[model samples]
Target: MNKPTLLFTAALLTAPALLALTACQPSGPVTNAPETNANSVTTLPISELPLHAEQATRLDNNLWLGVHPHGDIQIRDGQGALVGQQPVAAEFISQRRDAQGDFFLSLTTDNQLMFYRASAQGISDLHLSAELPWPLEGMCLYQPSAQELNLFVMDESAIAHQLLLTRTQGELLAREIRQFPLPPLAEYCVVDDSTDQLFVSEENIGVWSYNARAESEVLRKPVDLVKPWGALEHNTGPLAISQGQLLVAELGSDLLHAYPLDGGDTRTWQLAPIAAGQPLAADALTVSADSDKTVMAVLDDNNGKVYRAELTLPARAGDNQRIVQVAPVAETRPMRKSGDAADDPAIWVNQQQPELSRIIGTNKKYGLYVYDLAGNELQELVVGRVNNVDVRQGFSLKGQAADIAAASQRDRKAIALFSIDPLNGQVSTAGEVVTTLDNVYGLCMYRNITDNRFFVFINDQDGRFEQYEITDSSAGWRGKKVREFAVKSQPEGCAADDRQQRLFIGEEDVAVWTLSADAGAPTDMTQVAAVSDVLVADIEGMDIYRSDTEAYLVVSSQGNDSYVLYQAEAPYEYVGRFRVGINAEKGIDGASETDGLTVTSQALGADYPAGMLVVQDGRNLLPDENQNFKTISWDSIRAVVIAP
Candidate 1:
């Protein structure tokens, strides 16, 4: 048994003046202290940066800042001093500082807007600016008429929705000026000031553009953005705009896409590997307009930090540009290797046992592995084909021995109870398997804080979902079917927002289904967002995160190639899309069929301080392969934009 540790909570009171003073520093600027030196910086050759560039800009004269190896948004100068930085909170989506030098940040913690004034003294006067009606995922800063700064936030509320042109004075005081409804879980939006239109990228559906002036309707026909390469990865980062062209980062392949602003032609630029063996996460990316050229920054999540380089244009002189890699900055911790078959990671933060934080990962062959915050495998529980797993506390009729015994004898002769051992990584059958669920794909634990009752939601491969009650203890659980819902297609991923009493289900080649627990029975199924296009292929994994008032749904496309991220629609809106994949060259013998995904936002352990997303590379199945798992740093994963 893992011993539980005690925790105490104490409120620290400080004078408002002191609090204001610390806010001025805003986590302190990256200084060129003795800690960071040029000798410590590694500069790969320009050819190593790979991908051909349609357009490249020089942001600074000194050195080209590539992607940050670390996850933090710190753009460094040639000397390695932090030039620009943005601080993000848990569940927060995106941050930007406009050309006017005003800083805008989103708070996923509560779907609120926290603004900061950046002065020479640093970031001071932090204040809450606006309260969104619902939680948000992706956000962008646009100048509608050059007089006002319009903040557009993506909300996947009921379907896909958008908060249009919320005008804010400067960057701090933001108020809602208008709103618009969009397709479910739109990935990213780019404002074409040249045409007074906003182009939104909807994963599987295509790209739709709406007139900023006419908020009621879409202006352009939806265009298909799918590439032969496969479904794009999800949650990489923001798209880039350069010289009448939109640059989109492809998550599955090492390719940068260029879409003509006039909507005439689309082309792809493949990035070459910087090092012979180095892998690229391509999570987050930033572009800067330099005096003479355009510079781009791509974050490598597989490695810890960012890569700064120059984008080289095409040979047409105006069409071709070159991207050069320059410097790298180190983050707090080095990226760890994601475990083999480590899928669907869930965190159980014990309030009664605060220090007893445990992360349970589903391993198809090895059962569930519990790990401490330090990334040490504490124990492994043997559950067959553990596609999905969750934990909650409580008892229900479904888990009662009488129910299990009756159900076991009536249906399958097997019992349905599990026993776990923390120290020895062992699990034994506490009861027989009651009913062999047909294609059990997803699982979640629903806790009723009000009554302390726990419920389980499981998604079956046969286009149906079942609910059960837990009667036994945390380790030993018996389940009885309470309700079932049909999804039409294979239901691969499922997540529950207990606070909101909502569940998100991902269907293959269909939209995501949202079910309200408050309504009697599980039949009240509604199409919250469509995944037919957003996910490259069939949706296989899903996870929901609630930060304050907002809820985020992350769905995996096991068949296609990437993960799709959606914000709640009716109560939320489609924010943006992110892409996930192992770097192109890093693939085992250069293959790209990636399947199975699991994500967590809170730090699971010390090694994974910011949280993690684990995916399975189908290419690694070859018996001759040296390693079974490929782990990318979560920080690096959030650095680049999967699509522009």
Candidate 2:
């Protein structure tokens, strides 16, 4: 039974702020309804079950399951007759029936989380499949794909845990992928896989919705509230979602509320008033619907009498936001420190042996890290606090041709340089060149295709950018400031296209601007893309993926944890956006709040035949390790966003 006492009102007195979260909008403006007669739609009790059970839910039109007083599960028909029973002991149960008529159950046994599977028609005999030692109050299952199943569990202290479950060699395994906080007294949770939405009921407050995708931000929006705040007369009770409506039961009333998942008016159903000898308490509820009819079941907590009813509801309206989802093929090792340690990544292609290529990443808190194609840490250069890094090949240093890498060393307020041996792929610190700016933040390197002259562009946090000509002489290497420019606001994460002689820079809170890569050419800036629905704010990383015939620019929309693609040529057309989702099979969590990224079109090996894109994973979850970089094959991205 739902807890009747509303003991969390003072803690949640800041209702104005919580109600303003717009990620999950309400069905519509809620109007207060009377307690005894709430826009009543009559519902008649079809049957009553005589059993001492705590909770009851409908499996199909003819079968229902409940927790009997004997600690086992009991099955009953629609006409209130006992049919079958399953002796599985469960303290709490959550059931879901997929489109294929397969039933999945999440049950809490003592402090362990267990999963059961059975056919909808044969639910009396369930197959115990998976179990994990998790002390959770409730659990809900979300299926991202046909083969990937994830469980979201609610603990006793109002915390949510997302775990990915897998099977290997007939053994089941569960691993924690992510975790987030929930409002105090959060009791019930249900997920709509079709809409990628998670609805959690706060006992003393209302129903809140969240984006169920593992890669999405943790933003909760209100669905409805209690009393003068919204529409309910008392605290919220059990919640069920079916046919696009979030069905909510009132904790201490005979009324039920149905809120359309999409925008629409709320509908209230008034159950028949209690008679002289009928069960009086409505504690648990279940709802299911098809194309033709909708059915609801309510459990009487005191006497274990089950009540069933039919509902006539309007059609469900759907306006779901759709985006492509893909997972990383590999991930680098965790950084040495936590927090925002990893900032940028640059890939170095080995011309002699593509498989021997390496990845260069900036550990802003420490120094630099070098990793091989298989994500093994090969070397570390402890220079200073480097923010962003870029790599270019074929630079003359000390009368020898070498690969050059540059990063904005914030600690030194200069440009940190490294020389990579082309033959052995070893990175050694060359030296640093102080900049005129007070603070150097972002850095990128470019080489002129016409004269093969190398240059590095460094930006300050105050929006000042200075281009320096990097030349090699007898005294190692030197940098001379050539041109200086500034944007209206802070800028970082710039990429240079050597083939097109163009440079692209992301103005953190503004738009992406393009200028000439040649130091002597005009520094006219052109707005390529602005912050919008697809391209969210705080645009961090920008890179170009160029093949022999086509090129596309990718930008990290840090505000939304998604990446937006565009045509790299003039009049850049918006292509699409995609998110790096969790790889349940490999146990690799997706990237979120990315800072800097790099991509190359040169084939590295069999794993990344069409090149790879490396992005800094700001919040690395699966095991909650330190921040690191993730590598995704370009072909995997093209298959979803660019395939025509």
Candidate 3:
């Protein structure tokens, strides 16, 4: 309940300092200043096409496909000669082509999206390969790799959706991964794949740019604006990225503006006149870039005429952020409650049959959930409002050897305990021990390899932490406060390396710290990692993955929906970052906005021979159900991100 206040305080206290530094940087405004070689472009008139197409996309240097207003497509050569036609039977409001020359068109009526293959043979080869449902005003495609295709779409209400499409088993699977707000009256959008940036035009406002990656933050930077705001003469129109520049068309000015992707002076070009000194009212535009030359096509919507011109493009280096993508193998059934109810997850390995291990997760709003390895809900313990949970094995409970799981119960401000039956994999509540903290938040358990003693560490929302040693008694399980400490800010996640006697604690907006796990040891701490580009702010859950040879530390970079890894030893060398993507074949959506994750290196089965990773999915999509947890095999991640 106090989470909102903590977040607000962090932002309020940090905004001034952040803004002060931003103010000192030069304002790289989008200006009307032309490039050094302003008048070196040649303009020529192409033929007037016979078809009154609303929009057109150039397939190559010589082929163009025009979308007609009457629900048909006309294929024409560069000379305006019609080659073939196809009746699409749907009124498409927007169209875009990917790097592979495939076309994606969207219709507003049924909220339908259609896909077609591009072919140089003729329109006969333009067969519908796939279709999905989405409501949008305009859309553009971004291809990060040959196996991944991203679609950025804008709706009439000015909402943008980033959909990830993956090809699997001869089918294209789509998942809506992220959504954010946009200015009203926005119509056109384009993505610069090289930079992973999206540019949108807010009809009467201006052109703005946004980070296009699904894992990036939702922020808008001004590219250009209308008259008084920037250098553009009219409202923004069509948008395209070609030859290291963002080409923006002015709605009614018959002028084209080019802004370098890397901040530079803007260049303006006047389209060839349609008649004797009459400017063409450009509406739609497209550009084709190749090694030989760059071709530009502009459509005069008023007269239904298409004009073509050629220009030279300046050379610039490409800058791209590389993010590794891995798919989830399975996902648990969604929780009964909705809206951020799922917060943390823990894995309980079954000694009898490793394949039968269970994944324990906290509903936070309801209770604890137990799931089988196949992601089926095995049991639901309706304990009230448990925020975080962890498990430790070989604990003596009620005169029997059992696995113990501990969670911070916010409703009672206490530690909730459960005993897992190792043989049958059954979890039963043991007891709850009350704490003095105002609000109990994060919890983790540790077992001493030296003395075989079990203890649990719990932190309050105000940064106070307490360590308790679990003791078995005639009454039941109880905890004695052994040691206490505090961080400068709120800390939610703490993982103990029992073997190294080291404990890792995450201070939400600051950094990850380490200290001795020994009760009598000094409270001195060392900085493991700080919040940076790799480890985004609001660092949430973290756990250690121990292989036979080494141990790797995985921390959730919650701000950007990515996970960062480090060597979990002295020096703590940084590994790589990766994101869980949609598994097209299994129909399981990716995990994002994660709050807690747990990893184990015990070989579970054939699917998880190297170990498994289970994470809480804050935003579960694929049918838009309640939140759930996803499972990813560590072997798959090692194959892509870990070097041999």
Candidate 4:
């Protein structure tokens, strides 16, 4: 790898730039990235990339090569003289011949997929298609048949597999994504056009194959292809197919093994170095047919080297292709309204039956709307202007251990409390706690396991927040104000990390301030990401997603129509940020003006098996519809979190 270089290179801030949402603006110190706001992002001019051939291939009478990640992609003529070069940024690029015998390659720069077409005229830009949510490994283009070509990109984490429909395409389509499942992370993959199969090499596991088309089974299991080859614990290189044999590059051992799909014994070769005195440190591999000869190529990351050799063929391995990667999806709450109303959500996980879990959303128009993980509205409560909501399970409510939910009611200027039915996934109003603050807005739950008590922290539009404790009374549920906080401007989004005893509050036009979640605890606050820099004005919603080993804070940059993620604990390091871009598959629009968001790290159902992230969409339109809550799979967010 080209050692981690300048990341998030530039930082520019202006007053007018702060006024608009940074939906598409470059938000980081990206090296050489242009200053952008609300209009463009993920930019890299072809003239900026410097070319140094890390790998090279001879195809269509030309030499195609990829430079360093931040360097250029170059095309040279048959005489090995540079014909032309494109300052294209990419960590790696690989080429394959199309059915028409022309070559095409995928160049990945910062996880954004770029394509180049190689023909008799030389190499030309194809499309800078899919915006990968995270840095991933390997990519392939499949032509199940002529007139129907698709792009497949692998997620480096065990989160998801994506297919751009195309995230950006030619005269065919643009930015359509379909997501599917595969091994957590795939290091190498190749498409067998003859059998219409896609094979993904799962290091230490084995070679796995799947059908290239939709509706076909994907990543069922690994084919027992590597047991005879020996343990491939550090198989970080590539895999290729020529004729009936499969060529596997063992990077760790500096060896190459060819396995015949038939019953023949596997052949092994000690790979020759790209240069004298150097051993092969393969990063990628490719196999091609030159007339009756089989040619293979290897890319070395450590040495910036390229080597190619010819190989012998083996008999066909039968018709054994399975299925694999599709694009991602965007979903929203099923209920519709005449105007923007939906504000926040709270997820209740039914540990016994994952599918029975419910997503409780506050429809500011009237009350709390509950939906299944699939976005189907299950129930709605006319509780009067519920704005932001949150839930915490395993609470000792009235001496009974159950789940409790609360919301800030704007109309009543109170906190509406509900009892969650863990069994049937139903919710009913337990009671209400009228607050002293005017114009209630945001609310979150905190359960003190030490005292076995539950608390509700509610904030208002006037920048005042009160922490109240819910106690069981002989009459009904009553709340007592435990502590109070005040900020300089409007305050809305707030979340309490019961696990860490910390609370994060978003001061609309200011920044996120943190303090103790305990009653009577000192309010020594710390600023997280402030306005105009890490965040634009009106930092909206905040929630904490607790994974197995760590926790992450998810924030809605309402002013910019984007969501920012953080490490959640002290010294909250920024992970990354992403706007809920359009989901062409569902005809659903991305989110903007998000007021509140909530997350649950539990598999609610098959759709959200890893978990679900629910955010309120300020502008839920395209056909111009009213606002509602959009649900993004937490797995999608996890991909970015796990990315380098």
Write candidate 1's Cα lDDT for 1-644 as tens digits: 01112121111213453334233422111111111123432332232232111111123344332221123323344555555444533222233445556453445354556555433343444556555676664565554332334567777662223332233343445444345455564656666454445656655433444544312222333322332212232321236665555556644334455556544445544455656765455544556555444466565545534455555433222422111111111101111222334445555453343334554555554555566433456665554545555544333332342211111111232223443333322334455334446656656656666666556666556776667655565445556667677777676667667777787777767777887753255477787776554555566666665555445676665543345567754644655544332121221111123334445555544544545555444333212231122333344444432222
Q: Which of 2 and 4 is the better model by TM-score?
A: 2
Show the lowest summed lDDT stretch of 10 residues, model 3: 1-10
Give the Å error, residue 233, model 3: 1.6
| Each candidate structure's count of clashing pairs | 94, 0, 0, 25
Better of 2 and 4 by lDDT: 2
TM-score on alpha carbons, each prediction: 0.42, 0.87, 0.84, 0.53
lDDT to native, each model:
0.45, 0.77, 0.77, 0.65
Q: What value does the lDDT take at residue 113 in candidate 4?
A: 62
TM-score of 2: 0.87
Answer with 3 or 4, whichever has the higher TM-score.
3
Measured by TM-score, the strongest candidate is 2
Ranked candidates (TM-score, high to low):
2, 3, 4, 1
- Candidate 4, which segments miss by more than 4 Å at Cα? 1-118, 121-330, 396-401, 584-588
Clashing residue pairs, candidate 2? none
lDDT minimum window of 10 residues, candidate 4 = 1-10
lDDT of 3 by residue, 194-301 (tens): 666788887765677777766455666667656554566766898888877888888865778788877666777777777887878877777777565567667886
Candidate 2 lDDT, 96-207, residue by residue in tens: 5445554555463544444554323444323344555546766777876554678788988788888787756544467777677888888778887766788888886777
